[model samples]
Target: MKLKLISSIFILLGYNSFAQNAKTDLSDSLVKDKQVILAKYVPMANGEYLYKGYQIPIDSFINRVNDFRADFNAQIAKDKLSDLSILKEKDVMFYSYNVLAHYQIYYGMDSVGMENFGKVVQEKRGEPNFYKLIDSAQKKAFPKRLSNDERKRLDDIIRKSTDLNDAALFKTSAAYRTWLNDYLKGVQRKKYLADTALGYGGDNVAMLKVIAAEISDPFIKEYLLYTFTGTVIKSVKNAGAKESAYKDFMAGTTNETYKKGIMEIYINYKNMSSNAVSPDFNYTDINGKLVSLKSLRGKYVYIDVWATWCGPCKAEIPFLTKIENDYHDKNIHFVSLSVDRMADKAKWISYVNDNKLQGIQLMADKDFSSDFVKKYNINSIPRFILIDPTGKIVSGDAKRPSDPALRKQFDSLLK
Candidate 1:
């Protein structure tokens, strides 16, 4: 009876050991799978290095990454100490908090408790704080500096406001107006400096002429007139024209000189426009057939200037495809011109195929410097330009096809 009992106990122990080993094996397999998933999605350096060059396992590194991103997004959405506490253990929490604070301030949600969040944000400026991080990012992104005058203006508005709502309203109004005024002033200054340095000829002359017509500010108008007059005087000297003629032109009333300068600028701009037509472009289509813009002149054309890497451009493609399908019977032609470099041609083509772009897909081998981009003055994308049947520009600022109103307009035009 004792021997039988001992044998039964040994059997039970063996069973328990097997179960434990099985559980351990399952856990190890799950961990390996998770690591593979992380390696596939997250950017891994040397398959070993992790955040900021720290060497860690792919699974562990990705967990931290996901945790950091989630905490940062949460703080932005929920601007409170409790939400921030989620990232308390993170070393990079300060940077994430700063971003969250700026986002809150921008959306006017930072005033949940503080009456004037914008003022607080401004006053709280300095490195290691939230506002400074935002400011640093802005400086890196934009070419223009925040002028002292503009800062003073913002400060005055903040000082006047006793509550968040008042401060937000004041900022919304004053900030927009100040931006417009400063933009006009900056453009005028740039034109004058460019003219002085590069001479009032070539591209500078063309650009100055365009600016003269487009600008509406009185101070900018006066500055442009004076600069043009100075240029004309220099031109006369270079041409060896009589000094008397130069004096005669200079002696005229500022108003008359301004009018003449404006006219001259307009004429020059017109000439430049005439000479700036998009050059004949040749790019292989999906089927490896060469296509050119000059060949598609008879039909109304819609050009989509975009790059594969541009998220906005990618988002608009589905809408563009829908528009193309809806207007297939019409004489309108849709073209997607990609500014992705030639090296990325295969990838571009793959994306077009994968997304099934209905419109004609063409690559700009020279990328951003492509002649069509320069002709259209495309500073940002996804830009849409419509050319009428007669070849004149129908609308330089055509809306994205996702806009229902724009789609309606296109349908009417087709009819």
Candidate 2:
């Protein structure tokens, strides 16, 4: 009987050991998969920052975020934290709270999402925080900076604000402020990068290609490319460098929208060249008279493309009127083309008459996509175009009427 009992004890112990080993193996597999699902906010980089000369695994990071959201919503529906404890910060709890707070501030979602930001962000500013390594440029920008209890807090505040003037203070005081608010710093960063990459390049299309290729974030890449295109193409009098830039970009990308946008802008530059003839338009005036571009061929045309809803267009009006009055007797004609929609045709007529807008006032046959507007790809307005007496485009982007340069340009052209 004793021998039988001892043998049975050994068998039971063996079985228990096997079960324990299996449980350990199972746990190893479950941990990572569970963490990916339950975690919130993707835990904003542990203690590292990425800017220039670096890239992140954006696809994987986004996948983790999506997984977390799915699991979070499921848990919310069940009305249970499951294994969560308030005594310790769980990844799900931390993320949910922060996302809630983020929504409150940015999305006006005080009553929505998860607002646990109040708890996780309890670490006071200037504490041993996770936001990592300051760049060399940021360090130099704040040379005479005062020591702060929390420099990171100041950096965070300045980066989130919309005002550039408000940002000036942070530039001189905070560390790691360069990456804070990109809307303010983005243009400057790209210009510096472009200067380094292309050697103060007028080959904007080439510069754009370089910027697009270098940037990983889709939004920023698109924005930098688009913004620089305008600056580089504003002067259409010369197109040697631009032609090369355009060619390079065309060969590289398959993005249809980008291709279309760049192509239109390029065509606009060509259309507005001093060497190329201006795109003509014929429209009916308020007096029921048809005025055509060819009819005014002997005189220079300073065309103002505007609309009723455009605040910038309105601001230029007083200055434009002054130009009209000053140059009334010159061998020039100031033509105002209103791109106001058909719905606002009456409003356009009323505004023109009420303001007593000078020179030739004619309504555009169509809005921005009109044959005339598309010729110069006039995506934005208060646009001023200058044409020589022979109807050849002298400038696609002429000086604004308010500019003293406009008066100088007029005097030069009239002579």
Candidate 3:
């Protein structure tokens, strides 16, 4: 009887182990499938895809894009691509369309191909073959018919050309400007839109700034400059002061050289305050002890704003660890604050421990809404903020450790 019981127990254990392995295999298969699909659609030259005039190496771009495509495909595979769903089918369509736009912008479609692509997207006013799958998904997903406004927005975007300089032949016609504004307004009506909507953030901001700086039209250039300055560095608390400085900077600037000059000015401004006023913050350390930035005021403070899920942030850990080791006795303090949601505390702590980071690790319980982040105007991650001994603003544009000059600066500063 004992022997029979032992054999039965072994059988059950084997079945359980097999089931777990199968589950893991299935998950990996889905991930691999998504990668294959993206690779097929977005072919890279030497494993790099250039977008918006930026050359993104294949490995880096693929790493970032794969997550987005996988989440999108997962929703589609699960038949959840409805209008009310968080991952709406329209979003996928827009993403694909935007990717194609970037691809065209970087690669430059042949004259004939460009003309034909524009004609089919615009004059036809029907679903193009490439977007048929997305269209079908949208129709099934949306219970009510698409609003006229929504349809018009999609049509306009589809008809838009990748060529930015061809004013007469471009997709966002003079008339479409009004439509674009209305579309942005409608998006605001939604609870919250992603940063990519209407190119509010992401590469669009950089692209527009570059164009504004290079364009010969004084009025257009000024407008773009205003938009860039307003969005990038304008703070309500210091508005009048910043504006006065900006006006003085722009007084003698002409359209011909204004863009390049302003870019230089901005870079200088960023560098000027690179190691400035230490921002005050409170966070819980890995041991669940509350730590305050004020306590570290006497020493050189290296504050890194990052998150557990941020890939770039994870990649920088090794370099950061090395810096911490080198500067351990230089009266310098290193602190890494994670901006992950409060619910992710466990994951944040686990990541810090797993990475064996020597620097002080803390969790930004308030996440992006943290007062320090708002004060710093932190829109992106892997940001390094250095605070000098006296707590006054010094240099704000400290280069990454990877840069030779930055390493030299660090070595000098430590000395």
Task: Name the top lDDT candidate.
Answer: 2
lDDT of 2: 0.53
> What's the lDDT for all of these models?
0.48, 0.53, 0.49
Q: Write the per-residue lDDT of candidate 3 for residues 27-59, one digit (tens) a residue.
A: 111122332455554554554442222244333
| TM-score ranking, high to low | 2, 3, 1
Task: List, residue by residue over 348-394, the lDDT tens digit for candidate 1.
Answer: 88988987887788887677666655544344567777776656666
Which parts of model 1 are misplaced by more than 4 Å? Answer: 1-279
Clashes of each: 1, 4, 13
Q: How many angstroms is residue 414 displaced in model 3 relative to the true structure, after the best TM-score fit?
A: 2.7
lDDT of 2 at 399: 88
Instruction: Provide the TM-score for each candidate, comma-separated.
Output: 0.39, 0.49, 0.44
TM-score of 3: 0.44
Once fitted onto the true fold, the runs of candidate 3 whose alpha carbons sit more than 4 angstroms away are 1-157, 160-231, 234-276
